[model samples]
Target: MKVGVVLPVFNQEPQYIFECIQSLQNQTFRQFKLAIVIDGANAETVNAVYEASQVLTIPFQIINRTENQGIAYTLNEGFSYLTDCPYLTWVSSDNRHYPEFLQALVKTMDSTPKEIVLVYSLYHRINEEGINVSNSEEMHQFMTSLMRRPKEQIYSVCFLGASFLFRRQAFEKAGGYRNKFPIAQDHDFWMRILQHGDIYFLEKYLMEYRVNGKYSLTTLTPSEDLILESMRSSIDNRKTIQDIPKVSVLLTSYNQCKYIDHAIESVLNQTFTNFHLIAVDDGSTDGTQEIIYQKKDSRLIGLFLNHRGKAHALNAGLEFCLGEYVLELDGDDWLDPQTLDIMVREMDKQPPNVGLTYANRKLWNQVGEKLIEGPIIPGLNYGDKYDVLSNLQTHCPRLYRKSALKSIGGWKRFIDGQPAILDDFLMFLDLAEKYDFHWINGALYHQRRHEKNITLIQQEEISSEIQKIVHAKIKEWGNEYIPEFIFNEGSLVKVDLRPRGLS
Candidate 1:
C-alpha cells in the first residue's frame, strides 16, 4: 500500500520548501504519494511549492487555496483528499526526513498489529547554522517516563518531530482534526486519537526539525504567547503528569493581579514537586492573566475565561484536573513551602474512608501587611461526616481525594445567575457526607484577607442557602446526621479550627 504524505505549506523560504520535497524524494522506501497544499501564502512562497512539485519524479499533486485556512484545515483537507492511501502523515515545509525515515516507519507498521494507531520516532533539531543538535531533553525524557508508566495515565506534547505515519482508520475514527487549536492542531489530534488505541514508539531518529523559521514554535509572537501557553496548559493538565503527580492544586483567581505572582511562586516553591497547578483566571480585567503568563513553570497550567462566577470557574478548572488528590487555594493566598509534602503525608496515613484533610493556616491582611494570627483552624472536628457537614469548612487550606470528590459530582453552582454563594461550603458538606476528614498539625498556607475578598461578601448572602443545603442533605439522608441536633448537644467538631494555643 502506498503511504500518502500531506505537506502543508505556507510562507516559508523557497529553498526550505525545495529541501523538504527533496528529502522525501530520496527516501529509501519509494511507494509514497506526495501532496503539497499551499495555504494562501505570498506569490514567492506559492511559486516555491509549485516548483518543488515539478521537479519530483514521484506521483504528486499541488493544492492551492486562494485564502489562508490554517495548518489544521490544510491537514484535514489533505487527509480527506487522499482517499486511496491506507497510511497518512504530514510534514511541515520547514522539516526534512532522513532517507531511512519512511522505511523504518513502514516496516514497523507492517509487523505491528492493526490496533497500533500511530508510529512515532525520535527526532533531532537543526539550528539555523546547519548544525545538528542532539535529541531534545523533552522527547528523550518523555519517552523514558512514558514507558515505565501505566497505560491508563494520559499525557500530551508527544511529537515524533514533523513526520509520523498514521493509519487512515485511526485518523478517521479520531474525527481527523478539529481545526480549533490553531498552532497546536496536531497536538489536539494526538490527544483525541490516543483515546482509541495504542501508539508505537521507535528509537531511531527519523526527521530533522528546523528551528529558524519565523512561524516555528521556536519563534513566538506576543499573541502566539497565549496560544503556546494554552498549549502547554492543555498538555500539562493531561492525565499523565511528570513522574505521576499525586496531588493537583486548583489555584483560582479573579483579579488579584498584584498577588497572583506570589501565589504561583509559593506553589512552585513547595517541597513536594510531584503536583500539577491548574491556574484558572475568572476573566480578569487587569493583568491577572498576563501575570500568570509571566510564569515559565511547566507545572502551571493557565486557563483564561470570560467573567464566569468563581463557582463556574472552579468547576470548569476541574475538567482538566488529572490528580489523585486535589488541593484548593485562592489567588490571594500563598502556601508554605512544606504544605504539600505535609498534607500528602498526612493523607497517606489516613484510611480510604477519609475524604478530605486540612492543615492550620496563618492569617495575614493585604492592607496591613502584618500577620493577623498564626495557626487558625476551623472550629470543627471531622471524626465523622455529620460533624464536618454541621460546621461547613471554608477555604482555609485543604486537600481532597479525587475519587470521593468525583462521587459527589464536584462543585455545584447556580449557573443561571442565581449568584451561587457558599459553593466551598457545599463542596465541603458534600465530601463530608460520604467520607471522614482529618487535620494536620502545622500551618502550611497563608490566607490573605483583603477588602475585595469574595468570601467576605459571600458569607451573609449565602448563609441561608448554606443552612438550606445542610438541612436538605440531612433530611434526604434521613438519619441521625443532623447539624442542629449536634449543635444542640454541643459536640466539638472533630476538626479543630482554633489557633494553635487556643486549640
Candidate 2:
C-alpha cells in the first residue's frame, strides 16, 4: 500500500535539491519510501544531496554510481531498489510538490477501477527564482485542456506534466523507460505505458515545474528530426481497435498546407463521429506531410507518398478504407459540421441502386485577403447519365458506396497518357453509368476559389480533357451523335445532344 518514489539526481543545484527533498518530507501521506540515485555527480553535489536527505524520517536509500548513465538508466536503477512498494513514481531534483500531492494521487489510484494503472495531475509553471511564470488561472486552463485530450492521443502530447503516480505492476509491464529517445524519454514512456491500461488525470496543481533552469531538459532544444522520429514511433506503436465505421473520408493533399488543417478539423469536429479520416499527402514539399502526421486524433490515418497525381493519391487512400460508404474530400475545401450526419442519414434511406449522394456548395473567391462570397451552386437532387454528361459544374462533397467505388477500381489514373484534369468529374461519369445518384439540397461544402485553384489555372486543359472523356464515354454507350454546346458570351447556355444531321 506504500508509494515508492525515485529521485534521480545529476549535477543539480544544492538549493533546488533541498527544496525537492523538503517537499517530500512534508507530504501528508507517510507510507512512502524514497530512492535517491546519484548518477556520476561531482563530490560537492553528491554530498549536498546526501546532506539534504537527512531530513527524511521515512525509509530512504542513496545509491551513488561512479559513471554517468542517462536518466532512463538511472531511473531504472532507482526503481530496482523499491520492489517491495506497490505504487511507483519518479521526481526531478528541481521540482517541488505540494503537501497534498501524494495523498490526492494515492487516493485517486486506490479508488480507480482495476483497469486504471496511472494517475497524473496538472502543475504550475515556475521560473528559476521559484516565482509563478504564468497566471495561475490561465496555466490551470491550459494544462486542463491538454489533459482532456483523448487517451489515444497521449502519444502526440505529454500532458502528464511533472506530477504522476503509477502502479508498479504497470511500470513493469511497460518495460521501463527507453534510452533510444534520450531527449524525449518521458513522452516515449507515456506512449508505451498507455498500451498496458488507461490513465486518469487529477485536475489540480500539485507541483511547481521549474522552467528555464540552467540544467533543465526544457532548455535543451531537441532536433526536429528527433521529434519527428519519436512521433513516428508513437504512431507505429498505436493499436487501433474499433468496429468498422459507417463512413470513410478520403482527404488528399499536395502543397496545400495552409488550408489542410481547416479541412481536417472540419471533418474531425463533425456532428457525426462514426467515420475514419484517411489523409494522403502526395509528396508535398511544403511540410504538408508533417502537419498530417502531427494530428492527434485516433480516427486519422496519415499516409505519405512520393509525388503523385490526385487520381493516384485517391486510389492509394481507397486501399485502406474499411467503411460502408466513402466520401472523397478535397484538402483545400471543408464541409459543414452536419455534412456527414445529413449525408449518412440520407444515404441510409436510399435504395441499394443509389450509389452516390452529393450536396450543394458555397463558393469563396479569394482575392488577396478578401474572401468574396459567390452564388450558391445548387446540386441536382437526382442525376442520370445524360444529366451528368452535360452539366459543366462538378458536384461538391460527393459520398459514394464503397462497393461501387471498388467495383470501378477507385479512380481512373490516366487517359491517353495524361492525368485526369477533372478527376472528380471523371469518377462521377463512371459512377453515373452504373448506379443512380441522390443529392441533398443544402450547401454543406465550402469551395475556396484562389489564384492557385487547379480548375482556374488549367481551364483550357480541363475543358479539353473533359471533352475527350465525354466523347469516349458516349461512344462506349453506343451513341453515334456527339453532344454540341450552345454558348452565350463564352458561357454554355444549352447542350445539343440530338443527332448532328437533325441539328
Candidate 3:
C-alpha cells in the first residue's frame, strides 16, 4: 500500500518550508509521495519547497491556488491530486516527521482493524533552534488517560489531527474539513469523523513540530473580535454531545469572600449538564462560607473545614465527588460556560488507559486591563520522563479520572519542608506516573493571576524545597514511577514523563 503525505502551505517562512521538506526527504521509509499545496503562498515559500523537493530527488507535486484560500481550502484542493494512494497522511508545512514515521505508522495500521479510521503517533515540538520543547510523558499520560476509556468511547475524548494518518475514505466522510472553523478547523473535522468510527494512537514519537519562532504559521494575525467569537463558537459546539463522561468539578478556595459569588456563578453557568461541583472551603476566615451556604444547587457540594493547606483541601473535596471524571478548578479561577462539557465529552471517547485530560487556559489578569492567551501546547505528546521535566513553561487547567487520582493517593503532602510551595507540582508528578494524560486544544478555563493567591505567596521558597524532594524521589522510585524532574536556577523544575504502560 502507498502513503501520500499532504503538506498545506500558505504565507509560511521559507526556512520552515525547506526544513519541513528536508525531514521528509530523509525518511527511512522511502515509498511515499509528497503533495505540497501552496495556498496563496508568496514566491519565496513556493520556490523553497520546490527547490528542496528537487534537490532531495523525492517525487513531489505542488498545487498553487490563485486566490489565498485558507488552510482548510488549500488542503482539500491538495487531496484532489492524490494518485491511487492507499492511504493519506497529513503534515503541516511548518512541521517535520521522523525518518521512521511512515514505517511505524504503516506497521500499526496493518496490525489494527480497518474500521479504525484514524491513526496518530506521539510527536514533539521543537524551538526555532531545533531544540526539543515538549513533554512526552505528560503527553503520554494525557493520551493514554484518554485512551483508557473504551475503544469506541474515544469520540468523547478528543479529535486527533495533523500528525494523524487517516483512511482517504474517512477523511472524505468527515467532509474534508469545514470552512466555518478557520481557527479550529482541525478540531471540527476530527469530531465529525469520530462520530463514524474509532481512532487509534501509536505510542511512538513520529514528528517534530516547530514552535517558538516568528516565522511559524501557528502565529495568527491580530483580530481580537474574531478570535473571541471563534473561541466562543468552539465551546458551544463541543458542549452539544450526548452520553458524555461524567465530570466532577473540584474547587479549592480559602477566604475568597469578594470573588466567591463570581466563581460559583461560573460553575452554575456551565453548558454541560452532567457534572457535579465539589467545593472545599479550606478554612476560609472571610464570608466565603456564608456565600456558599446561601447557594442551593444540588450539583454544588461544599466541604467546610479548618486550614489543611491546598492539598488536603482537594482531598476533602474529592471525598464528596461522585462523578466518574474530575476537574480541579481553583476557587479564585473560573471556567468558561462550556469548559467541563467540552472536556468531558472529549475524555469519554478516549481508550480506557487515558486517565487525565487537560486544556489551555486563558488568563484574566487581576488588573483587568487586557486578557492574555496561554501558549498552545495542547495535543503535544510527552512520552518520556525527561521531556516532561524539561518543558515547564507550558501548563493550564486540567481534568482527571477520579479513580486515577485516587490510585496516586490523591495529592502528596511534603513530609519534611514547606508543603505550600511545590504541592500541586508534586501532586501532578505522582498522578502522572500511574495514569495516561492528554490536553484538549481549546482554552476551557479562565485563570486569574492575583497577587494575594497562595501560588504567588509561597511559590519561590516552596517550589525550591519541592524540587529537591521530587528529584530525590525520582532517583529513589525508579524512572518509571517518578517522572524526570530537572531543576533550573529558579526553583521551578521541568518534568520528563512517559506513558506508564511503556517499558
Candidate 4:
C-alpha cells in the first residue's frame, strides 16, 4: 500500500526536526512518501528537514505556506496535495517514529476488515533532557476501548493528532480538519469522522512523543484547569457511549459493608460514566453482598464465592472483567467523581511501556473524615522500574494494564513453593520490571482505616507475605532489582500515624 506521511511544522529545534526525519526515512517499510508541510516554520527547521532528507537519500516534498497558518490548516493543505495516495499518515515535526512504526500500522489495517477507518499504535515520550520515557497503560487502555466502541464515542477519547493512520476515503469523508481550535483541531476532526466508521488499535509502540519540548502543550497551555475544562467539553458533546472505556473495578473485601457503599457511590457518581462494577466479596458473611445487589445498576457484576483470600478474590474478578482496564478498589476505599476520567486521560497520553498511572491516595477516618491530606508518597514520576519496586512496598489504587497482568499469568497463584496471598504485590512486581509506572501525584483514591479492615492491622504474617512477593520479584528482575532492601528495620521507612489533615 502507498503511504503518505505528512508532518506539520511550527518552529522546532533544528536537531529534533532532523532526527525525526531520519527516523522516518529508516523505517523498515520503504513504499512510502514523506509530505513535509512547513507551516510557517523558521528557516532553520525547513533547512534541517531538507539536509536530512538529502543525506538519507529519501525523496520528500516541502509544502511551504507563505503565511503562518495553524496546524489544522497545514494538515488540510498537506492532504490536499496527497490526493493520489491510498493510505495517509501524519506526525508532528518534532516527534519520531520507530523503524517498524509504519510496517506494524499498515499490516494491522490491511489484515483487519474494511470497516476500520483509523489505525493507531502506542507511543513513548522523550524529555527535554533527552531521557526516554514510556506512556502509561491508562493511555493504552483508553485507546483499546475506543477501538472496540461504536464510531461515535470512540473519537472523543482516542483522536490523538499525529500518531494515527487512515484511508484517504475516510479522511475526506471526515471533512478534513476544523481550523477553529488551534490546540485540539485533531479532536474536532476525529469526532466528525466517528459519524462515518470504526477504529482499530494495535498494541505496539510505534512512535516517540516528545513531552518536554519548549513548544509542547505543557508550555503552550500551562494552566492545568484549562486543559481539564477542554476535556470536559469534549466529553459533554459526545453523542453516544457505544465504545466507552470498559472499567472492571476489582473490589477485594473481607467484610466492610459500612464502607462498601461509599466506594460504590464514588464509582456510580463518576461524570464520565459507562463501567462495570465487579465487586468480589471475598467470602463476606456481612451484608456486603446484599448491599451490592440492592444497588440495582445493570453494570454491577456481583460475584459471591467462599473466602479464599484477597489474591483469589482479585483473580476471580479478573476472570469476570470484560473491561479494557482494571482498578483494584478495596471495599472500604473510594475514589473521586472524576477519578476514572482524569486517570484515563493521563493513560491516553502515556506510551505502551507504561503499564499504569497511579496517583497518590488520601487517608480517611471511619466517619469519612479526611485524615492525611496528601498522597501516600509525594512527587512520584513515571518510567523507572527501580522506583516502582521500592514504592510497591507501600502504595495503593494503582490501575494496572490488563494485558501486562495477563502476560504475567494473572497474579502468581502461589509463592515460595506454597499457597500465597498478597498476589497484588506480586503482580505489580512482575509488571514493574517489564513496564514503567506513571504517578499522578494526586489523592484521587480514598483509603479508610477502621476495625474491620485487614490493612488496619500490623501482622507478622502480612510482613511475610510482602517478603515472599519481594523475593519473587528479585528472582524476576535479577541484577536489575535493588539489593539490600528489607522490610524489617531500617530497610524500609515506616509511616507514623498522625492527627487528621496533617501530613
Write one digit per residue (lDDT tens) for candidate 4, span 56-128. 6555788876589888888888877778878898888678888999888888889988888888766766787
Cα lDDT of model 2 by residue, 1-503, tens digit: 39899999988789899999999999999999999999998887798898999999989999999799989999999999999999999999999999999999999999999899899988888889999886567666756776777677765455577899998998898899978777778877887787889989888778898987777876765444344445455544542434367998999999998889989999999999998888878878998876887677877867777777889889978876778999988888999999999999999999988989999999988787787999889997545687778775568888999999988887998888877777887888888889999989999999988988886677567667767876887788888567886665544444557664674
Name the top lDDT candidate: 2
- Residue 298 error for model 1, in Å? 1.2
Candidate 1: stretches off by over 4 Å:
1-61, 64-183, 186-233, 236-243, 368-375, 415-417, 479-503
TM-scores for the candidates: 0.57, 0.58, 0.49, 0.48
Model 4, residue pairs in steric clash: 135-350, 135-351, 136-350, 138-347, 139-347, 139-348, 149-243
lDDT tens digits, residues 1-503, model 3? 37887888877677777888888888887778878887777788777877867756667788877578887887787777774676788787778888888888877877888788878876776888778877667766754543434433322223243477777877877778767867656656666676667777777778887875665545553433233333333333444544323787888888888777888889888888877676778878888976875565545555667777888888766765667888888888888888877888888898877877778777665755454554433435667434444454335567888888888788776556546555665666665566666768887777777778666677676556655755565565674544555566655655655546777
What does the lDDT read for residue 324 in candidate 2? 90
Candidate 4 — which residues are off by over 4 angstroms? 56-58, 135-162, 223-229, 232-503
**After TM-score superposition, what is the CA distance of residue 297 in candidate 2 from its true location, in Å?**
3.2
Clashing pairs in 2: none
**Cα misplacement distance, residue 5 of candidate 4 (Å):** 1.2
Alpha-carbon deviation at 487 in model 3, angstroms = 54
Q: Taking the candidates one at a time, how many backbone clashes does each contain?
A: 10, 0, 49, 7
**Candidate 1 global lDDT:** 0.74
Worst 10 residues of 4 by lDDT: 490-499
